[model samples]
Target: MSQFALLGKRRFAPFFWTQALGAFNDNAFRNALVMLVAFQMGLDDHTVSLYTNLAPALFIIPFFLFSATAGQLAEKYEKSRIIRYVKLFEIGAMVLAAYGFYTHHTSLLLIVLFMMGMHSATFGPIKYAILPQALQQGELVGGNGLIETGTQLAMLIGMIVGSALMEIAGLGPLLAGAITIAVALVGYLSSRGIPEAPATAPDLKFNWNPISETARVLKLTGQDRPVFNAVLGISWFWFFGTVLIAQLPNYTRINLGGDGSVNILVLTLFSIGTGIGSLLCERMSGRRVEVGLVPLGAFGLTAFGVDLFFARPDAALIHGLNWLAFLHSAGGWRIVLDLTLIGVFAGFYVVPLFAFIQSRAPREQLSRVIAGNNILNALLICCAAGFGLGLGMLGLGVPEIFLATAVLNALVALYIFTLVPEFVMRFITWVLVNTLYRVRIEGTQHIPEDGPVLLVCNHVSFMDPLLLMANLRRPVRFVMYYKIFNTPLLSFVFRTAKAIPIAGHKEDPQVLHQAYDAIDAALAGGEAVCIFPEGGLTADGEIAPFRPGVEKILARRPVPVVPMALRGVWGSVWSRRDSGLGRARLPRRFRARVELVVDAAFGSEQVTAASLEARVRELRGDRA
Candidate 1:
């Protein structure tokens, strides 16, 4: 379906607006509060900074205190009903905010900030979980992209409008109250239009206590490794983002030398870059949750962040320079571009990770897992605040902090990649596939999205595994021969990818046992393990006889077996059929259409070596 269909669908459009309006109103009221205290009442710089930082703390506190309860509500009750209640809460919060504005009661305004947080906290699980229920699998990326872009844009606009309105003589409170109430009313109307999302766990008992429910949700997420890892990745993105964005205000004042205009510029550049990247996800991903983009994004983030630090103005701070003059100054324009690109890459980094978690998570427990993720995010944001404060106390300047954050991002990316090599491996494969051949995957639905599964494919070329890895959304552990697994330069790649190397029984019994044990463990952990059932590469570009080793593995593990066929790999330079004398002798610039066809999955009881081979052979047809 087209991406626009999401807006036309009753299920997604209402929730999208409700979320966008909520984000707009949140930022609007917060910005209005900041402007009221800072400019209208002429608060000290220290007080302004404290209030700015405290706002995040107040907002995030609800996620920690109430996210688990919110997840349970989303799972145990119809989502539409819950949304109506949340919208009503938003309206009530706006009423409190209106009162706070009329009385000029800063404390009441702070309390209203917490109330807004509570409203958002309750909406958090439903926001993510409802997408998978309402939209088709193909529309998930687009739907998420729209929501992300809309929210970011709303934040930018809300900050601008709120600040502008507060500066007016008599329009401040009226504008704040009018906008907040109108948006809340519109959100409530949208909530009424949201289609019914049935409860995934209707019988689940409600837990009013936060601590125990938080622990329960976390434990449930631990049961799914991929989903859990994706959650970690998402939370890390927030950590990185909080740190980066927090530095922008100071970076503009001290480094860019453009007063308030610089703040707007930074926000505009970063938000626009992120929105562009978010929208591009639908196109770049080809309508699937392509995680390879995540690594690509990480690379760009580090590259741009480091460049931004170096690109900062060399001169000491100057006063009264507008954004245009600032840009015309030495090294100023480059810094702005670098920051914008960092945000762009960050968008690339985060959007796909969210989509991956949503798509891979269990339908019944998705909301609970999202709640766990919210708790983690809140914890990380707090950590980020503490880290930033510590750095400032230690006499680190804003520029140095930016540089340190960039370097720290590189280190964190390295650590995460080291822990899960599948990210790096998939990145390499994505690069190769996109650069070399245009790959078209058919029958992707035939592959199970969950549970243990064995994929049997024809062994065609050295790039076979890379091809399959790039196409499949899930991480797959491949079983390769010892020789190929230990190849000089490729050995590091294989090892990093966590591929299992097996030797023939006659060659090494110990290695064979280890390989089988690894496969069993991977399956028990609910991972996809792929094996070339033919055992060895084709000697003459033809399907080889099936080996009984696959049958042995199945006998032990008893997982579903999926037959996959590869086309157009036989003629590739990496193919076993290639008899080139040297690297220069290999075929150059050969254009071939590569296809990875996924056939229906078969149970272990129905899949013998012979039957599996026949199924693969049929799919392979006359092509190798």
Candidate 2:
């Protein structure tokens, strides 16, 4: 189903609106307060600047101080109930904000701002952690995409609404306060519709000390090296975004020479692009948590960021161009395109990382891991501010700063991809599989969400493993023939994916023994392993007799064995049928229709080589 279909389901829709409304109110309240202070209060420039500078710190401090505690709460209590309570807290905070607005008291409004920050900090863990429980494995990427799109659009709308409301004569603050209160109440009402998401770790001992819990949660986040790096990648995204967003206003005034409307125009373009890119993730990933999009996103970010610099490096020749005037000016649409594409790439970069963390992290500890992620995001946001400021102090122009950051993004992405090669490996697989074939998967539910399972399939073509890797929600360790494992460019992917290289006994006895050992270890450690029980690819479009290697591995490990088949891959470019008299035949079709049929797993002791071969052949059902 389309991800939009989720918006109609009771399981998802309420929670979606609930979070989106909260995001809207958060930005609305903050921006409204900024407008009141900067315009309505009649304060000196120094005082106004001080208050504005202090506001973000107040808001973010809660994440630093309370995130671990909030994580524990999410783990120990029901999420829906907590969300309701959070909404109630928001209503109360907004009431205080209304009073503060009426009296024009900056200090009181700042305190309310801090309360809202605490509100968000508390909600942070539940925001992501609840999705895993409420959503099916396939719905995960789509669900996250919706949340991202909602949040971005809500934030942008909230900023615009809040600022516009506060600009109204005489009753601006009152109107802003009223709208915030109403939104908070509506947010609370929405929360009531959210289905219960039971605590992941009930009856667990609670940790009350923020400092120690913070350290402990960080340690927990780092326990998985790849997950930790994924967290870091998420934080880097915030850093990049913070820098880009922080400079946007000045970039509008100085570089584009556009008025406030033009500023809004650019922001709108970026936000819309982000929403588009986010919504596209589910379709692009084929409903899987495909991290390959990360590399693609990173490349776009650097490419456009550099191009954004080149598109308009110097100041505008004329001043005070309205948004329309700016667009009608030379090179305007190029600038717009650059910003929009950057947002699109930003969406591509972030959505998968969120899904990856959600899918890969331990369920019981997922909340805490997300809390750790929030803390790092907060830290990186601060760093981005400093980074932009430092660059400005170093006398770099805004465009130069953008260029420098883009270059740094390339470096950081390279470092992260190198640290976890799985991301790049998956990217290559996703690209190849999606480009070459239209893949259809059946009975994915037959593949267990967790634990060890041995997957046995007919080897129809060289792309079998990559195809499976791209489609399966869970990661797989493929056992391929040693010769295929060592294929030059593909070898890096195999090694990074930790594929086991096996050979026929006559070809290499040691390699065969090592492959068996690796298979055993992987299964013992509760991982899925796929082996082509045909021992090699089919010479014709027919199943070969199953080898006993699978039985041998199961005899040692005795995991459940899932039978699978690849259909309509027989005549693909990489298949044996495409090799005509030692010359490669041109692919008969591009994006050929391919289906992966999976059957229920059988108990290890329930099957033999003959029975397994029959089941796979049956599943193949006349399709090669």
Q: Which candidate's lDDT is highest?
A: 2
Best by TM-score: 2
Model 2 lDDT per residue over 1-624, tens place: 999999999999999999999999999999999999999889999999999899989999999999999999999999999999999999999999999999998889999999999999999999999999999999999999999999999999999999999999999999999999999999999999999999999986999999999999999999999999999999999999999988999999999999999989989988998999999999999898999999999999999999999999998778899999999999999999999999999999999999999999989999999999999999999899889999999999999999999999999999999999999999999888888999889988899999999999999988898989999889999999888889999999999989999988998899989989999999999999999999899998999999888778888889899999999998886888867447565656568899999999899999899999999999999989
Instruction: Please give each candidate's TM-score.
Output: 0.88, 0.98
Instruction: Compose the digit string of candidate 1's lDDT tens values, residues 425-517.
Output: 667766777776677788878777677899999998877777787777666888999899988866766786688999989999999999999
lDDT of each: 0.84, 0.94
Model 1 clash tally? Answer: 0
Between which residue pairs do clashes occur in model 1? Answer: none
Model 2's lDDT to the true fold? 0.94
Q: Alpha-carbon error at 354 in model 1, in Å?
A: 2.2
What C-alpha lDDT does candidate 1 achieve relative to the native structure?
A: 0.84
lDDT of 2 at 209: 99
